[model samples]
Target: MIFPDNRYRQLRAIQAEDFHTCFYCGCIATEFDFAPPKAHWQSYQYRQLSADNLQVPACKECVALLKPCTMGLVQQRREWVHTKIAAKYKKAIGVYLKWNEDELEELDFSLHHSIAAGLKLGEESHRRSNFQGFSHEIDGSKVADVLPAAMPIVLFDKQFDSLKDAILYVCKNYPITQPKLVERLAEQGNNIEAVVMEIQEEQEVAQFQRQLKIQSAAFAKKHNQSARFVSNEVERYLDKELAYSIAEALDLLYEERVKHYR
Candidate 1:
């Protein structure tokens, strides 16, 4: 049971039309959630910190996400809910970034239908995560919320509405896919060029390694050397820092083996 049970009241939107809108996501509000839950105000002084002691209308999902949150204000709860929503739907967000409606239309029926659902989910999650609450009043007096606005992000000499938009833009223009880019961004900070360069370098290294494996097998067979021997010699050279390139390492091993045979 809450201490200030009587003090807990529904936060009223100034406009009647905004009544059913979820204060966190602007979805059709199915229930209400108390910002700084009723149990939190253990003292009258603690309850006095919030001017309104607001209980904002929220969607069921938003309510569930915010259930464990212990924020002191509506704005904080909204921000927390947005962060959770973004994280929960990041894969869908990746789909949104990777493919657009026109591109989906060009796919085969089954593929289009499957991806289209993901794209729609991504779009809704993105929108809900960014929703700001409607204007509201506290005890018949309107007041401004202290909520901070979403800061626009600049990447690749282009300004985007948010980081999500920037990521989507990068996905469209670069060979890098959305998930890989997101992973690298977390690892490499927000430097778009650095992320792209690192991924490109990794791809090059992987390709070279694959080619080396095939070439080394052929080189071993031609030189009458067992593949294991060739591999062991190359590993020894690399471990000793004697050869940088696989070609150079293989050539050195072949020379040494030929001299031994002779």
Candidate 2:
């Protein structure tokens, strides 16, 4: 299903939290880009509504480049990409931190060349008249490379309970495969069954918290009080509930897949 206007706003908020730039290319992100591609979720198995975890803000150029890399390829190449991009980011950050204004301007061309060369994106990047806004190109690759390698990305400013849950969430919400999830978790040396257990516990906690909030909200409304007057406790609880709900949904999705496989 298409995301509602509020969901778009939620995506925008995520971008704003990340400084309103594409997480991969560091260019201004005008749209939400699903990492696994939303098209991956259109199959009969995954035909559920999309969730925010599968998305990251990305620029048009980066999106175009990434879309061609299928999920199978992504699973295979993710580690190499992460290692390379992390090294590049570390090196770039070191140079950036050490450079003064004059030094920065002097090295701008070379930095741009380095990014274009590294990613093999081509000469279009070089044709740009200015390099000032290009600093993020390096940073963007760094972020993109690490995403698949790292589990439990912070969304809406909260860490997911486990990498398994995060992967399952993406699979349920997007068109990703069970093997891809298994591969990612394996790369991290995590047992898929163990991770699922952890996710289950987290989901239960979230469900209990959500029920409490619902009851509290109902009570306030019954007393003719403003249900909108949410206390900080309620807000915090709600955020946790949301996080847990995503994990729970992922857990249910995974169970279905397991049954199908069996």
Candidate 3:
């Protein structure tokens, strides 16, 4: 089953300047080359991708990689448009730093805020009413003693992909000490320099160890031999980029051993 999202639909005619090919497939796609999803992902499989924070791309084919299914080129093509938009906003923020208050307001912050918030949540679940008197707080404690004038308004699609992209954009483009902008946003109790979210580490090891113990105990009762196991928790501490590199190494080693046996 495939579900279309509205933010995907509204993203019909956008692209990043340097974005000449797909990130995964490396296919050349133009702004007109893609069409937006005409609702939302309503199936059981995509629910995990949405709520549980999977890093799967929003293509029909990518969704199908969930072990029991597959998605078509149409689905994959549909999602690159969004990547294009995210890339654009990143560029836009860089451009904004060149302008003053009057010039910045003319860029239409209200419309962008609406679009960004919708992408972060979803169409049906997203509400303008939800943003009333809302503000973003900067936690200087986590990063450095760096004083940011305000928090950047970053929109995350999944727990990792979109959020990381936004962070990279800020770090590459608008990273500076804008005291005036910071002070003004602080006065209003809302910052607009970066998006901040609460990050909680999952106690995966403890949970895994507890489950392993139960399984081992059951096995011992049947055959009186200890069940050996390995921990997969190394993924939690490594950054997503590094985790991929590590997974690749393990996967290649497994393949090599299989080839040697053959």
Give, for candidate 1, the lowest lDDT window spanning 10 residues. 1-10
Residues 53-72, candidate 3, lDDT per residue (tens digit)?
Answer: 11222233222222222222
Off by over 4 Å in 3: 1-75, 97-262
Considering lDDT, where higher is better, how would the candidates rank from best to worst? 1, 2, 3
Off by over 4 Å in 1: 1-6, 15-17, 43-52, 145-149, 171-175, 186-262
- Tens digits of per-residue lDDT, candidate 2, 1-262, equal 3353322222332222456665544467766555345455444226553333245555665555555553422222233333334343443432322222333345568785664343332222311111112122222233231233324444335466643345556556534364554554455454544545555677778777686567546644554444444333345544656654433433443354333653
Question: Pairing residues by index, what is the TM-score of model 3?
Answer: 0.17
- Model 3: residue 141 alpha-carbon error in angstroms: 54
**TM-score of each predicted structure versus truth:** 0.62, 0.25, 0.17
Question: Which structure among the candidates has the greatest lDDT?
Answer: 1
Q: How far is candidate 1 from the true structure (C-alpha RMSD, Å)?
A: 6.0
Q: Distance (Å) between predicted and true CA of 17, model 3?
A: 27
Could you tell which candidate, 1 or 3, scores higher by lDDT?
A: 1
